[model samples]
Target: MAEMKSGYIDYKGFKTYYEIYGERKDNGKKPLLILHGGPGDTHLYLLNYRDMADLYDRQIIFYDQIGCGKSNIPHQEDDFYDYDLWINEFFTVRDALGLDDFHLFGNSWGGMLATMCMLRDDTGVASMVVNGSPYNCQTWLSEANRLILYLPEEMQKAIAEAEAAGGDYSTPEREAAYMEYYRRHVVGCDPWPDFVQEAFKPENVGECFNVMQGASEFVMTGKMKDFNVLDQVKNLKVPTMLLSGTNDEATPFLIKEAYDAMPAGTEWVLVQGAAHIGNATHAKEYFEAVENFIERHE
Candidate 1:
């Protein structure tokens, strides 16, 4: 088993926490850098990749983006939640760790961030895997609305009411209704996993989530509400693999838009019976596909 080492990096005076699983071996492959979802999500849920590092003798990296998880939180102001700030942090962490070669894996918002990073600089990226990410906020909301209609009529009503109240998902009925949508499109597992639950704890929830992703998944009243990269995805020159679940909020249609926009030869995969976080609900298939993709590129 590879030993896990954890540490913090100082970036622009802010502290970002990171954990590395498995020491670099002479396997001739670069480390796999993981980017967690949420404009504020922690890297806790991504711990599933630790197994891949240990078993495959591959190095895996996980980091809590600034203002999330174990990282230091900046002042709670909307101005602090800039997309370029996080993108710069990604490069800072990569260079700080001396990762000249790496396979980038970004989930959800992370996937969106990864795309932005690759577009900004693709020099060091050997390959990329985008999981359950949205290329356009409008498309995401449209698909989410479509999915919401599939919920029970009462639940749909509750959700609509909650959204109308400015995303006030405080009532038990409203919360339950939101969870119904989450279970169907977010985790796709019953008895929500501990790591998934941990991500929403008070300390784990960062200002970026509210400032960039809005108050809730269904709402888009944030700075990133208009974020769209479909027009520029074609600029990605790296070998990329796009992954999404059959029931993901990043619906197949949206994923297809990204896939079709990417340069030829990019891969697209849909994990059946899984939702947004396929690495958690469908670990076997998810890791197998990831490992095979990385190996093929290597």
Candidate 2:
């Protein structure tokens, strides 16, 4: 154990819990603020990166969003569940921790949030990295739905039948089928590790995920339905690295559009053998890419 420290910061009438890893040195190692995926997911899966705090001689800040994981979970009030609220909380965390300028890396939904944060303000980010992120919600829905169609006919039918029956997303058979889709697209290379499997279990918070990102990958009924940052990438104003795997659910087509839209100084790299979670799927290659990018910028 590296003797991690935990604390709570008050944000928007609620308390958000976060953990700090590795000791800060006088050499000015900027903290890496990590935003985990799943609007409702905790930071448990991202704990894998704690070593990066020491490896890169940097600090890693991992926090559970309001109403998820070890964070405060309230009921009967979904008004505070929007993405903007999360961004506000992120700023609060940054200011409270005195993170003047730092590195930012996020995956999946986390990646989307990181971009949002960067767009809002670059005062606290020295560099930005977006991994396996979607540029447009509509395009994501189209691609994800297409992927769903590639599922076994029987499994797809089972899911349709289950949904037709009612809101039975909790059914054992439906869960199994969903896991199959997740394995193929979410993790890419089959047989996800145990920590990834653990994340599959239902956390069952408010419908934050559904309200902010829809019920599944194939649907876009959330507030992000019209979200598109393609035109704004040129305004990034920060050194940015757009990374993705060939087989990612994000797909190279989407990532290429995003990269082309970025400012001229922005850079990109593709991980060959990995999928959406390329950082975890191809650790050495991924880390090297990250290290090289940071060295160039730093």
Candidate 3:
């Protein structure tokens, strides 16, 4: 196994931590940056990418965003956490690591951020893979609510009632109700992974998510309330690919809408028998699809 090294980039005075796995090779493979989901998720969930060094002979960078994981936790909503803040942080980390041009992979929220970076036109992002992510938060939220209704009537009612009353999202009852739906639509047909469980910091997560995203998957009550990248999707100037699972909260309809809106030189694929966390649920198949996407662009 190759050694993994850690470092931090000072992005506009905020320190952002990142890790580099394996040695750089002249295999002509563009370095790959893996972005984890969540306005609060750490890069720990993406540790699996460390092994890809052997398969692809490219640098894989993993980092925890501010207020999440092994990174700096800034409680100030005013300065630290925002869409543009994160986008700039990505470029800061990439430039510090000397990644001139690279392939990008992001899951869920991370996928959305990756797309935002690609749209900047300043960053020389070579290609991208957005797995199980939607282009517009509003459209995706509607799909999530519809999927939640498919559960047992009792479970559906429990969720609706709690949200109506503004129940605490950190409570055991709410967690149980949400987890039931999350299992089927978020991760799909399996028990929650250990890392996924570890990543659930209810207190901090609730504040961060609610402030930036919303109250529920269906609720759009945050700074990103009107976040619609639909108009800009067609302006994507890089080789891009989209991935979604059949049971993904990022429904096929939403994915197709984004795909259809993209400029030419893009592709979309559905990972069979997987859901939102397709990369984890079906590692080999997911990685193979990603590998093909990167190779095709390279």
Candidate 4:
């Protein structure tokens, strides 16, 4: 087992939890910082990635963004969750940890946050890997809703009706229909791993997701609906590798859209037979591509 270190950093007035999964050394293998999605998924979902630290020379860092798992919930009533708040929170963690140089890996919304970091400043990021992430919120909405159109008609009606109703989307009918999409595009696993299940717990996605991503997968009515990083992605100088599953909710098309705007020489990999959480279902391919990208940059 890699040496584990856990602690908290101050974010506003709350404590943000973080962990490092390896003993730091002066080795050229810089640490890998992972960002989990949800504006709200906890670091628990991505703990399987500790292997990068345990097996390889790299250390793996995991942190729950404010209002996320293992961290104090930010003020929901005050509308505290937004892209700027999230991006700022990330820097606070990085600086507090003194990670002057590192590799970055993010999944789903986490991947979006990685891009936000590079957009703000690429100073300490050595390389970055984004899986099932979106470069533009509008494109993310279009692609996911497009995938929804292909679901069974019953599901289509349930989602459309529920979204149109714009009330509680967790109703039995709405949730039942969305589960179909979740199975097909989110986990792509018959029985989800315990970690994945934990991350999807209702409590795991709280006010942050409510304020940033809204209540349903079919639409993005939250503040992030206008978030788009593609225009600025073209100027990023860091080595970037974009990954997406062929069956992903992020959609191969949207991944390619982001890839196209990325700086020249950016890497793109599409895992076959995988979906949103490709790392869970297609670990070999998903991680090999990431390992290769990080090695090249190192």
Q: Pick the candidate with the highest lDDT.
A: 1
**Among all candidates shown, the one with the greatest TM-score:** 1
lDDT of 1: 0.88
Candidates sorted by lDDT, descending order? 1, 4, 3, 2
For candidate 1, the 10 contiguous residues with the lowest summed lDDT are: 72-81
Q: What is every candidate's alpha-carbon RMSD to the true fold?
A: 1.0, 2.4, 2.0, 1.6
Candidate 4 stretches greater than 4 Å from native: 167-172
* Candidate 3: worst-modelled 10 consecutive residues by lDDT: 199-208
For model 3 the local lDDT of residue 245 reads 87
Model 2: per-residue lDDT, tens digit, 244-266? 88767887787887888888888
Candidate 1 residue lDDT tens string, 160-242: 99999989989999999999888888888777788778776788878788888787888888888899998999989989999
| Ordered list by TM-score, greatest first | 1, 4, 3, 2
> Per-candidate TM vs. native?
0.98, 0.89, 0.92, 0.95
Model 1 clashing residue pairs (backbone): none
RMSD of 4: 1.6
lDDT of 4 by residue, 140-173 (tens): 8898889988888988888988888883556787
Against the unseen true structure, what C-alpha lDDT does each candidate score?
Answer: 0.88, 0.75, 0.78, 0.84
Off by over 4 Å in 3: 78-80, 167-173, 202-206
